[model samples]
Target: MAAGDIIPVHLYLCPLTLPGLSSDQQGRLLDTLPLDEQQKVMRYRMASAREKGLLVRCYLRALLSKAHTQLNQSSLNQSPLNQSQLNADIDGAIGPSEWRFDYLDKGKPVLSKAFFARSQLVFNLSHSGDYMLLAIAKSPRLELGVDIERLRQNTNIHAILNHYFTRQEREAMLALPSTRQRERFFDLWALKESYIKAKGLGLALSLKSFYFELSETECQALSFKGLDARQARLEQAARLFLVKEDSQQTDLGNDPQQAQPAAGWQSKLWQLDDEYRFALSLSSTDPLDLRCEMVSAQALLSE
Candidate 1:
């Protein structure tokens, strides 16, 4: 949480089934959003979708505000400042309306320069079925992307694999026992989504251009049902191979070592529940310190 210091990646998972906000609570949260965002939330045709959108946005703002306050306090504490001045500054938390964002060409949103200048806070969010996840970090050099998928039996696994996965990846996945193929499918899908999202290129970066190679060790690690927040360590689960722009094949052959490792990038995968798989990708050369928490809607609003 200290300014200019690398901090653990903090993951917050909120369930959509939490009690709905009262009208007053909804109004107060809506008031903090920009007009455009407010309209976007309201424009959702389905009431459930609208509520989900509103909750995510408000929870994100609340988390950002808390982080900003901590960063501000840290900076002030490191400087030669009177206790009263520090208290005053810390008390003046960044308001939700004060946050500004800019989107990349493919629509990944980032903090505007004005806010980013204070502290290099970065975050990414994903939602699936009944859950929403937010991953945040506080280092200038860190980039984060997180994905949560509700595994569904009806997914057209072969069609998607043929279209988006590299030849080797498809072969490797299909080689798995029939009983495990569906779980493996979601695992790779979540990992690919996380990588592209972390790169901030969205689907513009072809999924077929790169593939994940989980070592025997990594595969064993991924088998665990849940991650202990204190022991969550991101390892190099995949290597990136850039294909020739005009070529559709990955060309890495059978040996993954033939391709260069994705430097400064780390990833971790976890089975969140019987129906969900989660993946996180981050750009960081240092070892990761990660914390995962399940937060309630009331807790988020109280903060």
Candidate 2:
């Protein structure tokens, strides 16, 4: 992959609580979804989760509508509805018929053959605490995966890291002089989780298969002695390793199939707020030009 070939990614973040939307207004947003999605929203056992689900779908529909309209402009032009009418029906522009989903063997979601074949877009959704994140990659599906976690104090960082992290990693973490060991632990966890999510295998893959070395200004993935070097080579060739303070080569493992082969894969981390850390993995070797936007309450709850 060309180092200068930048891949543009759109990331939308919506706070769980909207500024002016009421319970009734939120219900109306849920109504805009097709029955299946509505059922999914209603099935949530907790009110907070249910509201977050509803808002996510609303944001998703808005994103989908914008993307689909841009892709099929000719069809929109041929429609009887005028521009004003089309704008007014934004929620219904790409209706239920145009959307489709399938699942990976391990249950990670994927776009159906027909839908992706037409739009070539891939998206991943993640929510934690008070925020919901939706990521979209344009044509030539990026096979993206995103994750966010609120930094909480209850996690047993040392114990969990000792159990799951590689010896080298454990040593590194232990060696850190900073008192923020817990924060560092979550940073590693977020990156690892996002990497696996991007692979679409979730936690089914062994944590020992890969380990990361993270610092304030550098991040790198290192392979074990017996690890599959071929996978490492593929990651290097794709240039999908973590960011560093300077340009340097990174190693991968033997399994190319772990990530989207054609598109390769890349991972990123961002501290979105004081209490949350966000991680993103994308199936692209090109440098990521991630565009993060905060969706307004009015835009999401509007017709």
lDDT, each prediction: 0.74, 0.63
- Candidate 2 per-residue lDDT, tens place, 9-30, comes to 7677767764545778877787
Query: What is candidate 2's TM-score against the reference?
Result: 0.72
**For candidate 1, lDDT tens digit of each residue in 6-46?**
55676777777656778787777788789999999999998
* Stretches > 4 Å off in candidate 2: 1-4, 19-23, 68-98, 218-264
What is the TM-score of candidate 1?
A: 0.83
Pick out the ten consecutive residues of candidate 1 with the lowest summed lDDT: 222-231
